[model samples]
Target: MTFSFEQPPDKLTWYHLGPLLDAEAGRLKYNPEQYTVHGVSNNAVACCWAGLLVDGDGGLVLTDLGRSMLASWKASPVGQRWLAEQAALDEEMSDPAAPSLPAPQPEPQRADQLGLFGAAS
Candidate 1:
């Protein structure tokens, strides 16, 4: 089956990527860091790296790619239909009122953190 830009890469098919996408788009009101993933997830993002990035706090942030893609999609006929759906979703979410997500907190210093294996510091 053909996949749309809204769908994550095949490697990430197992993961529920919509929350991550909505979070990036400011549509999902939840801690973005909670949706954090690395390794394979990073690879998937890399395929379409333009929209997503790891924030300083090890969270995800919507990048220019995300916004641009949405804008582009909204500009097209087919995508405009998708945009209408998204708008409906937005309306639904408006009433339930998910809490607004705050910016990521700074990563704390780990001075006493152990390095590598049995090697002494």
Candidate 2:
């Protein structure tokens, strides 16, 4: 979660917005009149940019670039482990195999759960 930047003495600090554009899709809409150079320095500027993609209901629908970034992250080892842990938790919550639970109890159903033919009853 931490990144270290090492620079030799007397080196000028340079930062670029190119990576931000890549990480967040160019779909980030900015108001030309309201957005000044000074506003770019604010931390909320990033959130403001991302807010453009949000629907009226306040839900974010990912664009192709965002989906690609998510796919790339899911392919990484850490992301894979995180995804696996989430799946395990979901499975445990839905279909608890613990002996303590009473018999004949039905497993909880999720809309997205996949089965051989359809969702298990």
Give the backbone clash total of model 2: 0
TM-score of each: 0.35, 0.37
Off by over 4 Å in 2: 1-53, 56-58, 99-121
lDDT of 2: 0.40
* Model 2 residue pairs with clashes: none
lDDT, candidate 1, 1-121, per-residue tens:
1222454333322133453455455554324354455423543355244333334233344455444454555577866676698888888779657666798764545433433245765
Which parts of model 1 are misplaced by more than 4 Å? Answer: 1-21, 27-51, 56-58, 86-121
Count of backbone collisions in candidate 1: 0
lDDT of 2 by residue, 7-121 (tens): 2112111121232333354443433455576323332233234331222122223334334545666677866887699798888878755445556844556323435367556
Q: What are the clash counts of all predictions, listed in order?
A: 0, 0
- Worst 10-residue lDDT window, candidate 2: 7-16
